[model samples]
Target: MLEFDIWELYRMMLRSRLFENAVMKLWEEGKITGEMHLGTGEEAIVAGVVSQLIDGDAIAVTHRGTPQFIMRGIDPVLLLLEFFGHPKGLCKGQGGHMHLFSKEHLIAASGIVGSSGPAATGFALALSYKKQNNIAVAFFGEGAINQGMMLESMNLASVWNLPVLFVCCDNNWAVTTTTNKSIGGTLIDRAKGFGIEGCSVNGTDVEAVWELANEALSKIRNNGGPQFIHATCTHLEGHLLGDLLLRHNRDPVLMAETADSLKQYAGESLNEVLMLLRKIGGQTKKKGDPIVFIKKKLKDDADRLKLIEEEVTKQIDQVVNNALEISKGGMKND
Candidate 1:
C-alpha cells in the first residue's frame, strides 16, 4: 500500500511529464494553435499542493495549470483531446492550454495574467458567506505579483478573512523576463504587507510542498484567514509552446540542473516510500516484456478513467435534477 502511494505520486509526475511532452509535440506538429505554457519541471507543486485539497474545495489556476487540472482528477485522455481541440474536450475545444474548466471539481483555470487571484478570493468569500469550511487555492506565477489585481485580491482576502491560500509559483522567470527584473519586492513580503501569513518552500520537493500546504489547509479549515506560500521552483523548459524553437533560446544547462535537483528530491522520497512498501510486502511486478508493462498500466488507467467518467456523470445528473426541481416550482413574488 505504501508502494502504491509512492508509485501513484511517481505516476502522477510521469503523467504530467507525458502530457507536457505530448502538448509540445502537438505544437511542433502544428496541431495545437495559440499560445501555450508548458509546465515541464513544476509538476511537483501542482501535485503536492492539490493532494491537500478536499473533494469540495475549489482551485484557481494560472496559464500553466495542466498539471493542477490533472491532479484534480482530469483524465489524461480528455486532456490530450483538449489539447488537440477535439469536440469532447474539457472546454468543448474552446479553451486550449491556458484555459481549462472542470465544473465538477470547482476549478476555473485561466489564461489571463494574475486572473486566478480574484477568482480564488471570490470562491473563498462565497464559501465564507455560506458558512462552509471549504478552502480555495490560487496558483499563480511570480510574474503575477506585479499585477494590481493580485494585490487587490490579497487585500480583499485579508480584510474579509477568507479561506484562501495564495500559491506563488516562483519559477525564477516570468516568461522571458526574470523575476529579479520584474518583481520589486519579496513574494512573502507582499503577503506580509496584506497581513497574511507567508512561507517560502522548495517547489521541487513535493514532500515539502505537501507538508506545508497540508498545514496551511488545516489552518484555513480552522478559520485561520489567508496564507501565502512562495514555491521557489525551476523552469526546465521555455515559457510558451514552441517558443524554444521560435526564439532560438536553448537552456540545456538549466534543464539538466533542474532535472538533477528534482531527481535528487524524488530519489529520497522514493526510497522512503519503497521502504514502507517493503514492510507491507508490496513490490513492483517482476521484470517482464516492455510492451506487457505498458499494456498493463494502460489497461489500469482505462479502468480508472471509466470510473472517473461515471462519477462526473453522476454529479452532473444530480445538478441537473436539482435545477429541474427548482424550475418546476412556480416563481414566488419576492
Candidate 2:
C-alpha cells in the first residue's frame, strides 16, 4: 500500500497550476526575463512521484521542474525570487529558473538536458559507498532517453547496483519536435537492455504513478539497485514563451492540431483544463480544471475542494505580489 496524503497532493498540484499561471502572467507583463517553459499539463506525474519521496531521498529534476521542487518541499516564494534573479532566491538569484537547489530538501533542478541521469547516479553511488539506504531519482524527459550520457549513466548504475530511480516524463515532444519522430524504442525496453527493471504508468492518473513509484522506490531502498519509469505525460503549451516562430511560421492548422493532440495526451477531462488555459490566456470562459478531477476521485466534498482552492490561491497571490513588489523595488532576493 502506498502511504500518501491525498489531500496534500491535491493541494500542491493546485499550487503548481496557480504558480505556473502567475509566472506566465509575469512573463507577458515583461516582469520576468528569459523564456518560460511550463509543465502545465504534467502536474499529476510530478506530484505523484515527488510526494512519496522520504526526507533523505534526493532527486535531480529537469528545467520544467517547479512542480517537483514544490512537492519536494521548496518554498514557492524563494522559487519566485530565483526566477526573478534576486539575490534572495534559493541559489541567491544566480540560478534563475534552470538551476534551483535546496540542499535542505536534497533536491536539485538542472538546466542541462540528460544531466539528471548522471547526477542522480553519482548521488546513489555515494550513498551505496556510505552504506546508506537513501535513494536517488533522476527526472528527465523522454527525449533525453536517447542521450549518450543518459545511457552511460544507466549502465554504470546497474553495474554498481546503485539505489536510483530514473523517471522519464514522456510528454511526447522535445520542445517543438514530437518524440515519436525521434525516439527509436520504448523506454522500458531500453532499461531492460541495460539490465534494469522498468515499467510504464498512466501519467494522467496520479494514483497510478504514485503506486508504481512507491513500489519501485521501496525495492531500490531495500535491495539497492537502479530502476526506470516511463511515465506518459502532457506539456500542454509551446516549446518556449516566444514559440510564435513554431506556431505562427507554420500552418495555423498544424498548431491547432498540436494543441488538440495534447488534449488527448493528458487527463481524460479537458473541460477544467481548457477553462484554466482560457483564464490564463485572459479569456472569460467558465470552465473547470484538473484539481476537480482529483477531488472527485478522492471523494472530496465541495466544501473541502473550496477550502483547498482558497488556501492555494491565497498562497499563490502572496508569492506573485511579493515577486512583483521585489521586482518593482529593484530589491535583491535576499
Candidate 3:
C-alpha cells in the first residue's frame, strides 16, 4: 500500500481537471461570457496552499482562482451553475469568471488584475486589530507585482506585521507578455524592499510548496511579519480562453521545449504528457456521456427549489437577527 493520502490528492486533481474541462466546453458553446483564465497546469499550487488553511481563515484570490476556490470546499455543481449564470450560484449569478465569495468562510475572490493583494492585506490588518489568530492568504499572478496597489499592500502588511501570506503564481508569462520584459527585478527582491521574508519555490512540486507554506504560515501565526512566496510555475495552455494564436510569430517546437511543466515533472518525453491528457480526456468524456444527468439536475423539482430557497433565506435572516441582538445587548445575558 502507498503511504500518504495520494488517492485524495489524485481525486481532487481529477475534479479540478474535470471542472476546468467542463468550463472550457461551456466557453466553446457560447455559455460563459468574458475572459476565462484556465488554471490547467497549476493545480498543485492551489491544493498545497489550501491544505494549510483553517475553516475560518480568509483568502483573497485573483482571476485565476477557480481551482483554489474549488479546493476550498465550494461545491462543483454550484460552481458549474454559477458559470452557467444560474441563481443557485455561490454569488447568486452576480459574479462570473473571476468573482467568487463565501461570506460564512470569509473567502472572497476578485476578477480585477492585481487587486486581491490589498484586500487580503486589509483583511489581515483587521484580524490583527481584533487580536484574532486568523490569517489571510492572498493569491495573485506575477503580473500583479507590477501593480502599485500590490506593492503598497506589501509595505502596509510589513509595517503592521500582519499575518498575511502573499503567494505569487508566477506562470512566466502575463497573458503573452514575458515576465522578463514586464516584471523588473526578482520577486524576493520586491519582498525584501518591504522588509518581509521571501522565498522562491518550485510551483509544480506540491510537496515542496506544502512544506514551505506550512512553515511560513506557522511563523505568521506566531506573530511573525507577512511572508512572500514566489512560485515559478508554467502555463500549459494559452493566456486566455481562445486557442493558440500567433503561430507564425512563435515556434511551436521551441515553445513546447521551454514551458511545459508536465514534461518537467514527468521527466519524460512530451509523448507521455499527450498520453496522460488523452487518458484524462477519455475518462471525462465517459463521465459526461449521460446527458440525462445534467437534464435531471436542471429540471429539479420546483417544490425542492422553493424549500432550498426558503432554507437559505432563513439562514441569512437568522445571521442578521443574531448580529442585531449582539449589537443591542452586550456580551453577557445579565
lDDT of each: 0.71, 0.78, 0.70
Stretches off by above 4 angstroms in model 1 are: 1-6, 245-334
Per-model TM-score on C-alpha atoms: 0.72, 0.84, 0.72
Candidate 2, run of 10 with poorest lDDT: 279-288
After superposing candidate 3 on the true structure, give the runs of residues whose Cα lies further than 4 Å from its correct spot.
1-6, 246-334
lDDT of 2 at 170: 85
* Model 1 worst lDDT window (10 residues): 282-291
Estimate the TM-score for candidate 1: 0.72
Candidate 1 local Cα displacement, residue 10, angstroms? 2.2
lDDT (0-100) at residue 67 of candidate 2? Answer: 80
Residue 93's lDDT in candidate 1 = 61
Whole-model alpha-carbon lDDT for candidate 2: 0.78
What lDDT tens digits, residue by residue, belong to model 2 across residues 2-50? 3787777788788898998898888888767897787676788888878
Q: lDDT winner among the candidates?
A: 2
Ranking by TM-score: 2, 1, 3
lDDT, candidate 1, at 76: 55
